[model samples]
Target chain A: MTNASAQAASPPWDDVSITVIRRDMLRFARMQLRDSGAAEDMVQEALMAAMTSAKSFAGRSAFKTWMFAILRNKIVDHIRASSREICGADLAGSSDMDAGLEEFDVLFNRRGLWNPDDRPATWADPEASFEQDAFWTVFDLCMNKLPEHIARVYTMRELLELDTAEICAELGITRSNCFVILHRARLGLRECLENRWFQGEAR
Target chain B: MKMMNCKDATQLMSERYERTLSLRELLSLKVHTAMCKGCSNYGQHLDVLRQASARLRAGNTSGEP
Candidate 1:
């Protein structure tokens, strides 16, 4: 029939497996928006756009690439709109977490050597950890537990893979300060994952 | 400068991703990591973390609803 012929011509957007890309899209959005609720909304919007433009898709590229293109644009718009409040930190006052840096001093002596009790322990079969869903759950929980500003910086630099210049420009921070922030962030995540996932398995 | 220790060596490990290390810094890290079990473990941890980030980039979904 005419209706059957028409349906066959158009790309099957409705039949597309969202399950194929949903988690990655959410992860992508979370790296940008830093809020799970906002990330979900953005992913939803991207999906809607993909569905509506399904006819225009020529199948030249992978469906996931096409969908991600839409999602990236949404993320850019969100960043531009939220740029004003990106830092969301009070410069006038220091936080108790600032004292957390002192903990590093205990790990390193005046000569910068690790104290006997402060050495990092060996982890068992770390690559295999990636295959376990529970490990990722612990990873996510640890990521969320990082101090707010540090977590944002960490996500930008590590997860998003933004260059130092871009991150410094986005956060309105100096080059050295950017490195310092990133260092602290890496240290924080390392310790958290070490304690919760790596060391937890040892027991 | 003071001899690179576990603390300084770990900091260098993180910095390795941002930019190429200088010859001196590179040699120091190699030497430090070679003998220190703790620093070696930390280096491996950094490598694992990088792999996890790479997985996120590749869009390999775990299909968690």
Candidate 2:
């Protein structure tokens, strides 16, 4: 990622380190664009852009966040250029697949109450450091564990901050479908984080 | 208000993020969660996850690695 016209300073990529997070950037791009080829191009563009601005990244913020911000802008810009009409074909994991929802059934009893054994335990004051890299790893792991369709919808709803109508339009799904996907995404994520992060801490 | 089961209440809690609840659904959820410890804790966890997700994206802009 070197530039011939650049100064004597080493490229900030060594500090920013794309090698590790390249997969993450690609995954996020794939989720947004749903086309691996386009996702690859987007990541390439973002990486090139980040390289252009490498000198400014004097470690002012977390490298991954800065890089992701650039990638997200590139992806969002690409989406805007294409708009809703063209996005339907290269969609992420198909939505109607139930997204591993059978696992959730075991959380409740035949009476539709939370089973005593599966009841959620209280997570006490853990507000201090969840944003740290360790916790973000847990978060990422839990997120990755979710089925793609669930993750795709949740990313639209939460990460992209799309509303019901917008998400419905983007995914070409009905409001009910969007809601069900979001519901299962949240349930799965909440349970995963509780077990992997909170309960792990408790133990 | 028609009483709802914990499963129904949990579904409503998640659905609220996508759409505003009808008055009856809202009341049912409130009443059910009020009396149900497990569901109440579940709601709190949901809230935490919501906030975390919002922050995740928002942090991208502010550059929280």
Most TM-score-accurate candidate: 1
Q: Return the clash pairs for model 1, or none.
A: none
Model 1: what TM-score for its first chain? 0.74
Candidate 2: list runs displaced more than 4 Å.
A1-44, A50-70, A77-96, B60-65
DockQ of 1: 0.53
- lDDT of model 1 at position A64: 72
Q: Candidate 2, which CAPRI tier? A: acceptable
TM-score of each model, paired residue for residue: 0.80, 0.72
Please report the interface RMSD of model 1 to 1 decimal: 2.7
C-alpha DockQ for predicted model 2: 0.40
The sequence of per-residue lDDT tens digits that candidate 1 reaches over residues A17-112 is 676587778976776566899999999998898888886666655677677778777776666566557645432123532534555456677777
For A46-89, candidate 2 gives per-residue lDDT tens digits of: 88998889876655666677787888778667655655654455
Residues B4-24, candidate 1, lDDT per residue (tens digit)?
A: 877788878988888788999
